[model samples]
Target: GSFWINAHIEAGKFLWQRSNKTLDSNTRLRTTGQPGDLDSPGDCLSLLVSEDDLEYYPGLPYNPHDCSDNQHYPLCERILQDTQQLLKDPLLVLEETISINIAKMENNVHLILDTIDKSISAH
Candidate 1:
């Protein structure tokens, strides 16, 4: 889910930069609950999460529950195991269609200052 996300940037020089459209994409990679799925919104997934997750990750409210501990709470042990395994991979929650490194992306943005060298070429 949340796989496809479109982003557009306007390229300009000596004047202004703009876009007729919004900076958003229509990437499709979803997993909606269906019959016999058993992973419906208010089912296994719902029963797995905690109140903190619902508040922090409003998007993936049940994500937290998946990692919730068993033998101590009312949640199922299988759910916790699945959730723990999911977190083991640094690439969890990210749709395969949207493969990206957030740290690298942020670094690229912050490195813009280096481009100043080309701002005014010397004769």
Candidate 2:
């Protein structure tokens, strides 16, 4: 059994998987072939190509393989020297900022709605 977590975590979320694959340089993974395979195993990730796929564009695509299986671990490059440094965690900081901004925006929207309701009652 082999498992490795790359330096792509944003908070608790995996930053590599996005709704829009173009946003990241990582290879987009192929969906599994089974029907309603939600409960199936193999949630852990891997980046390996089948021997037949060696001639393809980037060669390997990310996939969720059975965690108990052993595969060659991919060498991932770390962008920051010290991930423990708060200032160095760009993804975490950005995610936190976005969350704070969204909360403020929601509060503003609620205030605006209340003001509108009061104006209508006065009218």
Per-prediction count of colliding residue pairs? 5, 0
lDDT of each: 0.31, 0.46
RMSD of each: 21.1, 14.0
Residue by residue across 1-123, what tens digits does model 2's lDDT show?
A: 222334233322234432312213232443333322321322345554555444452433544444344464544532332434656578788999999999999999999999999999999
Score every model by TM-score: 0.20, 0.33
> What's model 2's lDDT at 8?
36
Model 1, residue pairs in steric clash: 4-27, 6-24, 6-25, 48-65, 49-65
Model 2 Cα displacement at 59 (Å)?
29
Q: What is the lDDT of residue 8 in candidate 1?
A: 17
lDDT of 1 at 22: 34
Window of ten residues with lowest summed lDDT in model 2: 18-27
